[model samples]
Structures are given as C-alpha cells and as structure tokens.
Target: MATYVNPGSAQAGAHGTIYREVSPEQLAVEQQLVDNVVASFDACQDPRLQELMTSLVKHLHAFIREVRLTEEEWGTAIDFLTRAGHITDEVRQEFILLSDTLGASMQTINVNNQAYQGATEATVFGPFFVEDSPAIELGDDLAFGAPGEPCWVEGTVTDTDGTPLAGALIEVWEADEDGLYDVQYEAGKRAGRAHLFSAPDGGYRFWGLTPTPYPIPDDGPVGKMLDAVGR
Candidate 1:
C-alpha cells in the first residue's frame, strides 16, 4: 500500500505501507500523461463526444492525482463497481443507488434544470419509480389499501406565468410508514403509488400514505461504501 505524505515529513519503517512526498519531476510526468490522454481524443469526429471524453478524463485524472490514489484503492473501486453490477436486476439498480448516494444524481438534475421563481425543483429519479403506475381520479385514495395513516395531498399545477395548467400529469409515490415501498415486497404488489391528471381547474388531490423517512438499500456495495465512509 502507498500513502501520500506532506513534504518534509518523515516515517520510521515500511510495514506493508509506503508513505512518500510527491516530487516535482513526478508531478510533471503526471501532467504529461493527462495531456497525452486528452490529446488522443482530438481526432474524434463528434465535437460533443470529444468534449465529454476529454472533460471526463481530465477530471478523473485530477481526482486521482489530488488524492494520490493508491493501486489498492483503485482495485477496491473496481471490485465495488463489479459488486454493484452483480446486485442490479429488474427492480434493483445499484448504479443508481451509487449515484444517488453520492449526490451526483441530484447534481445532474440541478445542472440541467435551471431554477425559476418559487417553482418546484426536480428530484432524483429513483429506481423504484415504476412506469404505467395505476391511474386514479382526483380525490381517490392512492394508497389502494396500503397500510399507513391516511393523508391527503393536494396541489394546483400552474405555469411560471401563474396560469393554471390543466391536464398536467401528476405522479406520486413513496414508502409507507413501515419504511418499505411496494416494490420491496413480492411481485405485482403496488401501493403508495399512483398517477393522476389535473382537472380543468388545474387542481388535483389524492389520499396517500403520510410522508415518512426511509433508508436506502444498504445491503449492497453502495451501502458498504456509505458505511466505510461513515456517512
């Protein structure tokens, strides 16, 4: 194992770990490597692809250099990604969990969707959001008999101009008080989730489980990462 130490620091013995300060020559070499990698994509035909690849490589290299990343740590990251892939399935997406836990998902959303005056901000598109969710009429109970305290959620959909937007699609889903989503149970089980359209007055309301806090799936690699980082 290798570790980075500040300049002028001294260590006793190397017990399966080597600590050292970065040399100026080594720093130049690292920059050269990054430059060469970035230049290799110069011939890419698509400007957007080339730009994305170059930025990704530059940032990744910068991160590695900033942390003085060790070979062991790199191997651990590879293993973590492998485990994430293994745990992903029809209903489970470890990669999304990884992104969500890292705040990357929310950051991406924020970057793409600019904030307006007092409007709702976009949130993470979690893996549990099912397509074609059960459709319900306004004022109907979206819980569908799911066990939880009855709570009414109502709002008016409007545009930035303060005009009501009729027929706007409204989708809502959340875990029950037990901190379990419908997808966590056996297949074909749907609860605490529904989609409805706003009425002519741009008003919609439905009965759903009261909002509750729930933990992300922590039995997988992403969970291990959070635990490892003391998050």
Candidate 2:
C-alpha cells in the first residue's frame, strides 16, 4: 500500500515540520480568477463583482468537488477552448455564437439594456454585420446582385408608448439570395447589402430578399459540440 501526500503537506514523524492548510490567501487568489469574470458582469460603475465573485466561487468550488475533476479533464477543456479559438475568423465567430447559444448573450443583453423597455427587443447581433456598408438611398434594393425572392421590409421605430421615433437610425444587413453574406462571398468587395437611414417619421423601408435560415458554420469545435449535443 502506498500513501500519497499533496506537496507542502507534512508527513507523520517529520520532526519540527509545519504543515499549513491551504490558507485564505491562496484560496483568495484562486477565487479571484473567477471573481474577475463576475465582477465584469455589470457595466462599469455599477460594480457587481462582489456579488458575482461570491456566487461564482461558491458554484465553481462546488463543481470541482462534485466531479472531483482531474488535471487531465481540465487540460482537455483547455484544449477544446483553444481549438474553438483557432477556428474563428472574420466570417465565422464560433465564440460569440457559442455564448449566444449558451444564453450568455441574452443574459448580457437583458442586463445591459434594462433601459430599453419601450424599444424593440434586442436580440443577439449575429457576427455578419459589416461596418461602412455601401450606403444606399431609401427604397434601394439591398439584393441588387443577389438572386433571392424580393421581400419588402417596412418598419417604424417607435417608443414603447407607440410614439414614433422620427429620424432614428435603423441599419439593415442580411445574407443574399444564395444564403451568404457579402463577407462570405467576395474577399474585399462589398456586395449583397445596403444601408439606409430612417425617415423623419421614424420609418424606414428596404427591399431585400428574405434570407433562409442555414446551419451556422459547422467546421469548428463549437460545431462539433453542437453535433455531440444533438443540436
């Protein structure tokens, strides 16, 4: 029979040897790693770190005990995370989508947009939005070079009470008839998109083909996880 002792632990009959149980200081450092993430939950200036960190520490410690996770399990998790990062690119953002699918994005949106009760409910902004899209005039077609069914999208930005928010900016972007964003197609050319500003009455109209829902990029670790989960 063999006895195993964690490093820094004292063995029996080790004369004058002192063994210090894991101190609060060491625990605090380990706890801080998780705390840092929770503390960032609130928009700066609200500082919910104390509450978040406390809960995180409690659950994280509990999880460690619950599974009795070994270092190998932790290492595999790290590798999975690394692969997830490696598969990300400009057109594909596995990490952001992972967060959204996991409900973290919705949670963050709900927490940060507490003031948006009257506004249109915000959803997770997918990763395909392109800045400086070719600005087009109202009623201009966004699917100029694409081949999807032409659908007209008309909406009015209004306050919660139904008062129109005149001159509000409503930017629109979506995939073309081929179910691909401009970024997904050409390397540099901006295609299959258009941007239009709202009218004075908070109304905006755009002509674009309705986009068909497609499976997110399935070539990454996130995709593999989804497959494993039977999603």
Instruction: State model 2's lDDT.
Output: 0.69
> How much RMSD separates candidate 2 from the native structure?
10.1
**Model 1: residues with Cα > 4 Å off, grouped in runs:** 1-20
Lowest summed lDDT window (length 10), candidate 2: 12-21
Per-residue C-alpha lDDT of model 2 across residues 1-231, encoded as one tens digit per residue: 112234577354244333334455655675576557665655645447556665766687645533446899889878988998887776667788788778898899888877565566777787666667788777888777776788988888777888877766566777765567777665565666667777878788888888787566667787788898998
Q: What TM-score does each of the candidates earn? A: 0.87, 0.70
- In order, the Cα lDDT scores of the candidates are 0.85, 0.69
Per-residue lDDT of 191 in model 2: 63
Clashes of each: 0, 1
Model 1 TM: 0.87
Q: lDDT tens digits, residues 172-219, model 1?
A: 988988888888886678899999999998999998988888898888
